[model samples]
Target chain A: MQFTSERRLDGAVREREFALGEIPGILWTPGSVSAPAPLILLGPPPLGLRKTYPRLVARARHSAAAGFATATIELPGRGDRPRWPAAEQALAELRRAMEAGEPVSDEIVDALILPLVDRAVPEWQAALDALLSLREIGGPVGYSGGVISIGTRLAVVEPRISAAVLFAGSFVPRAMFQEARQVTIPLHVLLQWDDEGNDRQAALDLFDAFGSKEKTLHANMGGHTGVPQFAGDAAAQFFTRHLK
Target chain B: MQFTSERRLDGAVREREFALGEIPGILWTPGSVSAPAPLILLGPPPLGLRKTYPRLVARARHSAAAGFATATIELPGRGDRPRWPAAEQALAELRRAMEAGEPVSDEIVDALILPLVDRAVPEWQAALDALLSLREIGGPVGYSGGVISIGTRLAVVEPRISAAVLFAGSFVPRAMFQEARQVTIPLHVLLQWDDEGNDRQAALDLFDAFGSKEKTLHANMGGHTGVPQFAGDAAAQFFTRHLK
Candidate 1:
């Protein structure tokens, strides 16, 4: 891993950009954390890191102010990362279905999401290895919202991620539900009640599938991108309760 | 309002039992608030005050610690109040249906909840008038859990009640769903996902019917009596946000 750029965000947070092989990622840490701070891995949004920077930096600053280090990696098919023909075809199919006002089929969902999950989970684990090897970042780590399926898969396969805060999005493949039932770590799942592109029942069903003894579903009144500020604050509180 | 008895609870909360005409009620206030404390009217559980005292007082103590006065009144045909034959019959019918593994009919649900909502809303308003008249208790007020139908009606009719934390119980009358759409106050609704007697879909539907633009549904894994401790704390946090 090699850091290509570094900058101080205000005086409270330090931001650094890095590359793990070909995968680009960013790390944020408190400028003044005394002891080793507990680490939280931010899940990259499907829109890519550059476009999602403002929101991600806001989250990073919030977590930094709370005495935690946060990081995120570009998904394999997002941003400047290389995208394969299969992934591009899946996206085109999804757009065509939406343009024709048709339901997104399970095959399209699997093709689009499953491969990303299959690739991203290992890359996240690798990033964890590199981030934790740093002198200041410490475990027990947590994963926060990106793709719901990726979060579910990480919660199931990744042993180091002790807790997660997931945003429920539509088009999750059926196979993810089976993986969801195996997730035992504490979870805080946020759902937008009126998200136009999302199925509310499907989100609730996925929440019910989690085998965690301490899972909470917080559904707020909004469409996608309309999540209330207080909801975000509550998610931070959940991470503080578990990771701290 | 006539004070029936007064006691100091642990030197931090002062508890007073009162009678408004024939209806029995209780009031709790923080011992050290300099200005008038904002009030929260605790909704009386279906199982009368005497039986629910332990839980009610726990909530009272919690709100008191947060610098709020909390109060509750006995429901009509419940607790020390007299029960009419119709109400008694409704209870009997509900129990028989449950024991026989049959669905409780809409008629039974209306008979059981509608009368309570009708009699209780006025009594709660009267209680609010009396409680707020006290020098120690002030508004804006929030109504918290008991029978959800009653909370819905109160949210619709009672102007003083600014926000509510409603427990999404089973058997909410269909009429209340209509009233729920009229409720404009912010709501924080709690649903026990696996409650044996509660209909999860019905709860979800009622949550859907609520017209409040600022509503939240916090669903936790549990049966009727298995609501996790953190869920209760979160409800209190909701009240604090709106009331303060």
Candidate 2:
């Protein structure tokens, strides 16, 4: 599965310069699309796991096969080769924009690094807005993030999206959860039992908090990277349930 | 987080003479009883991760805190300390019981390999049954197991349990999913993005089949052991949702 990137300009979809909020990113989209369909906004892990995107791409292909337009965005912070300065700068810009009451330019913020920051509310909001824009293409809209990205997405975007999926994410600060009174959409969380960083109870508490009447929680039986199969299926189901 | 094994059944609960169909396991209860209680049913990995149950007890203590009861069972095939013949013999007995369509005796199984297998399923079930039988128990039941034990539990007992959690488990054969039809309770599945053993999609598809309207899918950031923080939250939320 290969990802080809493009942009929508003047009501016409065209190839646009791929920039992850001023930081560089490898924008990936399906090479072929038959129609205007739902879009998937993929937020990859910000660590050095570029080879990992193939799995994400595989999931995107599944989404495309199911009749949705899909895209996997390599955030500025994480990919085969990451530019740390760009990511740090983006974070600073986000903080300044939020503090100065200015409209943040998502294209200028690093999507991958957004998760690593301890306080990423503004960055999270910017990422959410970018995802929402993609949703305007008219099918279903979905986002998948690793750890910090997933946590921020769940904290900021879960309520707005049709369906959201998180892989190995922890509870946002207790304050973020307290701030989120309820989540109305279907949310799915996947975690490992032996995960040393984000233990099982933390995941369950977040699920309990954001899980709507339609949420579901699944615990697979492996170590950190044991459940690629389930993650793919979750992406498909989330898209199918909402976008289809 | 202290785990002390006892050959003498002085502090044990529900201790009884060996009977038919029982599996050997440890019975761990919290020292204090006033706080929210937690019970961990430890099922270790099939191979390569030695001394699985002891590790689980240590990990669970960190999350379950002091008020919880944790039990680790020995798998039928592995974990025989002092190299007891009972471990292998118990498997033979289990196979016979399965072939004969007889109810497995929990007590007999427990006595035979209590010191041998730690984190096996049959042993886990015996421990769970024992915990539930207690009058002082008013908390949640959490489970952790290896690939085989996890699939076995999902195929055999997931529906019967109120809350179930798994780590890096493989797909429960399609035949089993077809046979089971649905899982009504809350399930937490945690897996890595690049797990080699199981087909991630197949497992998620199975969960999709059984998962309740409320479910969660989390993709951890690390390859094998990404985010450890989520584990604790997942346990707490799962127990709270199912136990309370």
Cα TM-score per model: 0.99, 0.40
Model 2 regions lying over 4 Å from their true place: A1-17, A26-34, A48-51, A74-136, A148-160, A170-172, A179-181, A228-231, B1-244
* lDDT for each residue of candidate 1 in B126-182, tens digit (9 for 90 to 100): 888899899988888999999999899999998999999999865888888898899
Q: DockQ, in order, for the candidates?
A: 0.93, 0.08
Estimate every model's Cα lDDT from 0 to 1.
0.92, 0.50
TM-score of 1: 0.99
In model 2, what lDDT does residue A27 have?
34
Q: Write the per-residue lDDT of candidate 2 for residues B107-205, one digit (tens) a residue.
A: 434543343323344455555565666665544565544553354344356433555565644334334455334555555656554554345566556
Candidate 1 regions exceeding 4 Å error are: none
What docking tier does model 1 reach?
Answer: high
RMSD of 2: 19.9
Task: Report the number of the highest-DockQ candidate.
Answer: 1
**Model 2 clashing-pair count:** 109
What would the per-residue lDDT of candidate 2 be over residues A1-244, giving only the tens digit for each residue? 1223555433333333244464333333444556556666565554433567566556555655566554444443555434566567765776687688775554543342344543333444454455445523554566555553444445454455566666654324554455334555555666665554354555556655663545545555556666645446544665576666
> Which candidate leads in TM-score?
1
